[model samples]
Target chain A: MTLDVLAAGILSGGLYALIGLGISLVFGVLGLMNLAHGELVIAGAYLASLLVVDSGWDPLLALPLAMAGVALIAYPLQRYLLTPLLRGDKSAPLVGTFGLSLLAQALFQGVFGTHPKSLPASYADSGISVLGLRIQTIYLIAFALTTVLCAATHLVLTRTRAGSAVRAASADPATAAVLGINVSTVYAMTFAGAAALAAAGGVLTGVAQSFTPTSGLPLLLTGMAVMALAGIGSVGGVLLAGIALGVLQSASVQLFGGGMRDVVVYLAFFLVLAVRPQGLFRKAATG
Target chain B: MIRSTSRRIHALGAAALLAATAGCAGNASSSSGGKNDDGGPIVIGTSISLSGTTVLNQIRDGYLLAVQKVNAEGGLEVGGKKRKVELKVLDNRSDTNTMVQQVRSLALTDHVVGLLGSCCQQNIDMQGQADALKVPLVMGALPVELLPKGKGYTWDSFQSLADGAKDFYTVAAGAKTDKKTLIVTNNDAQGISTGKLWGATGKKAGFTIAATKAVPTGTTDFSDVIKAGKSSHAQVLIAAMAPPDCFAMWKQMKALAYKPKVAVGVQCAQTPGWGSLGKLGDGTLVQLNWSDTAGLPETNLIVSKYGKKYTNLTDLGSVALGLHEATILLDAIKSAGSTDADAINKALAKSTTVSAQGPVKFVDNKSVTPTFIGQWEGGAIKQVWPAKGGSPLASLTGLG
Candidate 1:
């Protein structure tokens, strides 16, 4: 593949990493697969559209608020609804999150009117050349932002007192509760944090591509693929996995044409799962 | 315990029988194609994508408007009696399986004599359901060329892809370009057919096909496609994909600076949402089934009723299509003088009616509507071809 295609794929992978990180975080800590994670990503985009599209605010200016808004919405959901379900049937959270996904899709359609929407920006459809290689300006910004967020996420989990409580709760919730860690609060906070990351990715994705109410399914699958490839609890691996997916997709399109791009990536995903169920980049279980 | 279980099973059987009888009682007056003894409204059902990736709100509105106008006139006259038209609409959410199931239920369970169509590829899928159920189905939005030959249960009244492609080439003949074309389509039945038809039509118009690619739906990256177009130096670009795919491709095209002199986004750029792309959406051409300036029948009525809600040419065209399809179906029902499916189908074969898109007469189970090529200018689409009360072509400033 040409360097241009490679660059595009790598940059697009940054957004994928951002999307997968949230899903990976929730799965690692709570041991609950948040089917609504894709919705969370879309929720961020829709939330930002309120500010960016209606109020004419810069997407960058609206990103943090959108993140905060989605986090606020996710915190209580995990704390009250999802966390309690985790204590009961193992499948309840899965079903609950799936329900949330449907509900979110309905609410988006009802509220937004089913028209495809995007966050307009000066950089949305512009490109800049670096080292004689051209890249989309929005994707570049998204890549830089994704790297910083991933690093911040890693540092938060590895270097803070809050991080220690999260690790303690994730490793053994019952023991962490006995040790006065307030496991429920830690779980809620972790989910909320992951949701914020998804929102950030959502805003970036909106800037890069158009989204509809039902756009979350593809994104959810992509994130799931990244998580499956990267394994749980590896922030760096998520980034690598996202890039790997991006490169594979780009190369497949180049070699086998566009029709085979998804086929190749999905085949790789299935093969990776079959061969290494624990994942290709499985580090020590952070939990 | 065994005796108790046997008693419970008997109770369950009784309950099931009771529910089945109630269902039959509820549908006793419902008939698929015979005279209605209950003197109830004639039910015409449609399962459309009201909220999904491809929303047919305009088409649905057209169906409702036709129903409303007929009901306002005290309903359709059937077998020397006037009966109100009852429209049962179910949202399929753009899922083919859901659409199929909903269409089946509307025919067998609801016992509607006639069915109205959904948009795009769904209409093609609905054709099978219509034929298998032996219900008369009338639809627009799907091109005549894409309508697969099947049992004569489905009737399509819309612009033909061949006509649109020929009209596009006629428009392109006046434009300044090398005529080296690049065509990209989504890898679905409609998309594939569009690519082949347009490519063949372009060759007849003396345009050379430089590159052709078919990508699946939901493809966000178009760099490889762009690279092909650039390498081939294709000045005439044709893309047939969904709105979101076109949105991303348009953005990437501008970003990568491919700079095709002429571009037509079939089925993609027609959405009102294209205006959201602002300047990037400008100068892109779309095939319109109806234009206000074309002086089709009931244009004034459509404008008067839905002028405020639908301001753009694309949305208005969709509303017109809906109105056209509904009028044709209702007129067939009136001509048949009964709610019988076979009679309605026969009547549709001989249908000659005028609606929003002008005179429509079924020839080979299809009615070819007038085709008008429109271009996005400023934030709205204007009819730029047919040059009769239409605007002149503009440079593709969106690419630059």
Candidate 2:
């Protein structure tokens, strides 16, 4: 009955979709799950917090700074540490990413000490009446921004020259190279875009909840779940899965006791996977 | 004459053996360091979370401040030996494994005479190490059940509160009404223990069983729990989760526009740490044992002096608890006449402390201290229960 709750749920789902997009994109391009997605998200969040809370910069302004920070770290990390493993075996990159995730978790814990610090802003508390329901101003802003970012991402992946190169590389890298595409650049760009999306998600997260170094684990797990539920490499599927997961979560908490909420949602996920192994929204090919 | 000679020779041989045994015991005690008649500096190691979880920081700051204050006044006097009491702090990072490892390192590497530990009951199993080494450990804020039931370990571990579960139940029993209470707990040891206490108290307090819920820590969606409550027409909601989870849940309650008769529980009303929630925390009631009004004069003095050092809050209880740790250890060192582990532990077992939390005399349970209850009213923490010595109790309003 509460419209605000529905709005909030939808907005929350959007954020989840953003996170899922990153996971799916990584899997689509690299054919591997970047287990460190959560850490990257955390890195982005902390970077944003440092800028806004410590340096006294505007939170929105800190977004790109955080994205750039993640890219810088991710680039070198991928080049030096992750690349060597990629050449060896398929599971090698996956295992290395896991190690990197652990290392990132430890590093953040060592530095931040686990107490959650929030980005300073009045907008977090500011709200207005919309349709006689209480709607937080930040949630509205986050939703609009997330939507715009998702639209722009879809455009970049489907419409432009770089987008074509990235798609070709994902589909058939050898064919893309034969067709005169710099497959390496496309791979790097895809990873960078995934990192940037994670950063954007992190910025929204900073507004949504108080987070610490340990906050990354749940995020990474959730991201992976969304990607798996949606079928990795399906952008539209990720979006649908994110919303479905959120609604399922809301419904779970509503009907069943909280003890069974997670069990039920996970059960639904398993059932869906069993019924439609390619996911409910999975397409044979992108037109 | 022959019998007397024989007895004297036997007595001489027995005396020799007794002296040898005493030598071994003394050597064992002095293995860390020789017991100087003029007490040098006595170093006590603490493996507590100095940073993780703001509550732990509040405790650490309070503990350090007390140590500093005591040292400034003068060193501890034990058996006519003057020793400067020094607290060696190790950041346990809120991990039990880390705490255990830190304790071992502090004892073996740093050669500390005594060890102080985290307030978490789950980690109190480390007392086995203290027992094995014949040392004293002053554990802060563990539930009484963590210790063996109907038994006491006088040599190894000492607790501040004996009946913490009783305190929680007492608060719940006194607060509950005829409402169908919904109990939500985190999936952790403390959370589970809290749920059990609240469940027992809810029934005693005249609350009907609506639904008992458990959420994994860091749960974001509380809708399912809320929906279950909504369907059951739950009049009261009791959550045994942390502040952040509680904050999110309260916000969701607002978002759902679901206002029951009242929502109350351990984390929502009891914690002073959830101040970040602002208005979302209003009408939430939590029960705690420490308050400035009920605190000793020394606690207020300590807070006034050292309050400016941290950006975060330093609660009256945390400071008092920290002071309690220091005073209790100091008492043990004095009573034992030596900083030897076994001797100091013996002293700790019998010691009584007049701390900021008031008189904390340890009996069997380690979780029950001179207790009280507090509520967050209009963004300020106020003492609410145990009206014998504190301010007038505030009535439950708004949601109730």
DockQ of the candidate models in sequence: 0.37, 0.09
CA lDDT, candidate 2, residue B244: 60
lDDT of 1: 0.88
Task: Write one digit per residue (lDDT tens) for candidate 1, span B14-38.
Answer: 7557755753453333234432436
Q: After best superposition, candidate 1 residue B159: deviation in angstroms?
A: 1.7
Candidate 1 regions exceeding 4 Å error are A284-287, B1-35, B95-105, B108-110
Write out the backbone clash pairs for model 1: B33-B340
Q: Candidate 1: deviation at residue A125, Å?
A: 0.8
Interface residue Cα RMSD of candidate 2 after superposition: 19.5
Error of 2 at B364 (Å): 1.9
Instruction: Provide C-alpha RMSD values for all models, in order.
Output: 5.4, 13.3
Q: For candidate 1 chain A, which ten residues in a row score worst on lDDT?
A: A278-287
lDDT of each: 0.88, 0.65
For every model in order, the TM-score on chain A comes to 0.98, 0.91
